[model samples]
Target: MVGNMSKKFNSFKEFYPYYLSEHQNLNCRRLHFAGSCLVITLIFVAILKSSYMLLWLLPVIGYGFAWVGHFFFEKNRPATFTYPLYSLIGDWVMFKDIIQGKLDI
Candidate 1:
């Protein structure tokens, strides 16, 4: 229906499940984690390299890879579309969980 979305999140508990569902496939989740990690590293490198231009393409390099996995591998809508900020947060949280061995992908 593409109805207008509310810009408010009532709770993380509600949002986390949706986040997990959107990234259920192992490959999709792994690709997202890789993209995020690369993006963070790129940010630090950009700062060190004095190449601020790379900052402009961070979202594209990160989300482009992740979205490719979501659409091609997972065949699912990205949580980012429905929950931009929360989904961004979820990406970090999920990445942390993966690093801590609490998540597979």
Candidate 2:
């Protein structure tokens, strides 16, 4: 595994660039975006159908696809392994950026 596992960021803002840097691969970004979208859709479906069980799939869906991207495409350790909170925030922010064309997948 890569080292520097203890590097700390004071805030999500400080972590995002590093997060983006790790996701430079186009396919990795696309997988992260797709995973986030599926997570959002799963949440809505769970709410609308009153099937709370579906909510359990959120982490699997989100992290599964993302891990595949990171491991196979990006070939880097996921930031989530080091910075869970900021990494989560980075996921949504990156998703929004892709949608808004601020970032290209």
Which pairs of residues collide in model 1? none
Candidate 1: where is the Cα deviation over 4 Å? 1-9
lDDT of 1 by residue, 1-105 (tens): 222245466987677876776777899888998899899999999999999999998999789988988888888778788888888889888989899998896
Q: TM-score of predicted model 2?
A: 0.94
| Predictions: Cα RMSD each | 3.1, 1.3
What's the true lDDT of residue 58 in model 2? 94
Cα lDDT tens digits for candidate 2, 23-96? 88999999999999899999999999999999989999999999999999988889888888888999999999
lDDT (C-alpha, whole model) for all candidates: 0.83, 0.90
State how far residue 26 of model 1 sits from its true place (Å).
0.6
Give per-residue lDDT, candidate 1, residue 51.
Answer: 99
